[model samples]
Target: MIIVPASADTERGRPGTTQQFADMQAYNDQMLRAGVFVDGQGLHPTSRGARVTWADGEWSVTDGPFAEAKELIAGFTIIEVSSREEAIEWLKKWPASCAPDPGQHLELRQVYAPEDFGEEFTAELREREEQMREEAARAAARG
Candidate 1:
């Protein structure tokens, strides 16, 4: 996940520039060519973000930019790699996408697939996933 670290823009707007946009596309192209890229995104600044919480049979709403700098995730990138070490190496290659002023950060995270759910996932679940994947492939081929 790419985290836009806290700065003045948290409240009203997000960060962007033509140079950074070009840089991101360049980096994404590299990853796509390598076949490790799954998906990625950029988020609007916090002020346009929201939080939903539930407790005591009630729900609460909070708008961003949230004050807690560390908690916010500005964007995310999903990739498939052989190992955490490999992911780290790929993440390390992220081009500096920030403007000279507002800083940028990236967090590499392991996404849990059904296998991570252990025994509870069951053979039926695996079969369903496999069937879906096949369907998607067929649809893609048709398109």
Candidate 2:
């Protein structure tokens, strides 16, 4: 599985919020048709959220309601691909307007499944997972 992180530039976007959502919807539709993405979602601004961290015998908490757009994490997507090359290919097709500017960035990372741990139980777990996914796919197709 590949994870794609995306953020919107609320400060410098040219097409306005409505247009940005429309563009995102269109991009999602294309991804659905491509059959590579397993799931995706857009997120609310950081102003509505908070962050928590732990230190040496201490807990630190920060309130949201932040105004700095650059520090915000907007949303993410998970894609199932055969290889890194395929993942990169799909990422290259991400909509251009998703970012605030040409330098705006997206981060892609590969997710580790139980099988990656190389434990005896992980083998069985992976087998069961594959079976469940296949069953779910068949069910979706029938519906």
Predicted structure with the largest lDDT when compared to the true one:
1
lDDT of 1 by residue, 1-143 (tens): 33334445533454566787788788889989999888887667777778999988999999766776656666677888888888888777776755323444566668778889999889999899889989999998999
Q: lDDT of all predictions, in order shown?
A: 0.72, 0.67
* lDDT (Cα) of model 2: 0.67
Worst 10-residue stretch by lDDT in candidate 1? 1-10
Candidate 1 lDDT at 19 equals: 88
Give one digit per residue, the lDDT tens place, for model 2 in 20-130.
678777877887888876787656656556788899988898877566655555667788788888888877777665654455567678887765667765767888988
TM-scores vs. true structure, each candidate: 0.75, 0.66
Q: Enumerate clash totals for all models, in the order shown.
A: 0, 0
Model 2 steric clash pairs: none
